[model samples]
Target: QLGIVTATRDDGFVVRTLNPGGSPLYSVSELPLKLARKCLDVFGTASYDEESSIHSLNTGYDDEVSSIYGAREFCLLRTTSGKVLYCGKPSALGLKQGGNAGSRWQELIVAKAPKIAQVAAGHEGLHAVLVGDDGSVYFTGTARRGEDGD
Candidate 1:
């Protein structure tokens, strides 16, 4: 299967696709000129010389975006404000809001921790783990809570 990676920049975002052999398929910036100006404005003239903080937007299958067996793929996004969003096929046990024909990005609600630092989804895209800045971990998706019979 193919793999896709999305990274956030000071200005905008970047997306890259890879072939089954892991070779580069194509790379594109969400917005080039606007991103450049945004970077400059935030970091000043030294922005060019400085490194932009990059985060690897991972899929439910860990680092890879798409599944090799043709299962539905899901992408995770973390905003600057620490909000986590999900985009892809809907899971029966996952949050069910914010999905439409044109967009699938949905806000994942963590009762224990509203602010998330990172998140990882299962290969089946049915379960996920979230880590908060305070070092607390939370679980969501199709997994049943507690024992089977409670």
Candidate 2:
């Protein structure tokens, strides 16, 4: 399978996944402007260094997203406002159960790790790495091959 994430001019995001033409099917999800504001508002205002890629929400910049990474089963969005969002298989996110059947844009709550600066998702694996504003690093997903930093 393959995935794509695009940022619209209206400060919203769209995600699409294409599965091989066999058993599974293709899917698409969108994060409209209204919901985007709600997500950003959850963290109040944004703050970052002048030289940093991070930026405040709704600053009218071309792209408020700092970076986007996709793994074997999911995708991670790191915004310029220092927030992290995800769309894809919830199990890849370590959730035992309870998630949408398909992918959807949802906030990734990294307890005690505020203001994510960067994120790395394994394209061929289920692991993910997050770098915080305070230089703290966090990992999630399977422990396969000790990629979880055990």
Candidate 3:
């Protein structure tokens, strides 16, 4: 089954479960942007500049207003303005404890590559693949099964 996730103009999102096997996090038929934001802890707008480095309107991470993708356990959002956001299990992304205690959105940072052209999430949200505007490809998350081609 395919997961459904859409981003609204107000920086909010709509998530739906395609089947009963869908995760409980998005089991709800529809959740308002405000509520979704509150539950996912998705706040702030982040921007990246080649010269100025990375900056966030509120948090340390950011994403533009554009497309959003829902995976089994996480969501990958890519904006037309060249930013990427990931929200889901912090451990799935290999984030250290204490800093990301709860599920929240974080920017996908690729060294020297400030702009992102596309983003993709792997099954169960265990891995992420990103394409940078500079033609650079980035991969994050776990690879215990050689899913990352390591």
Please provide, for model 2 over 1-150, each residue's C-alpha lDDT reduced to its tens digit, 9 standing for 90 to 100.
667777778656767665666565766444343233432222222121122343333423343676767666666778878887766677877966665423345678888778998888765558888989899999877767877767
The sequence of per-residue lDDT tens digits that candidate 1 reaches over residues 34-137 is 34422112221211112244533233322212211111334455655567665554453355643331123455567768567776666665566667989988
Q: Which prediction has more favorable lDDT, 1 or 3? A: 3
Candidate number with greatest TM-score: 2
Cα RMSD of predicted structure 2: 17.4
TM-score of each: 0.41, 0.54, 0.50
Error of 2 at 87 (Å): 0.8
Candidate 3, 84-130: lDDT as tens digits: 77665556566564333223557755568868888777766568888
Model 1 clash pairs? Answer: none
For model 1, the superposed segments whose C-alpha errors exceed 4 Å read 1-34, 37-73, 96-102, 112-114, 144-150
Q: Which candidate is the best by lDDT?
A: 2
The TM-score of predicted model 1 comes to 0.41
- What are the Cα lDDT values of the candidates? 0.46, 0.64, 0.60
Better candidate by TM-score, 2 or 3: 2
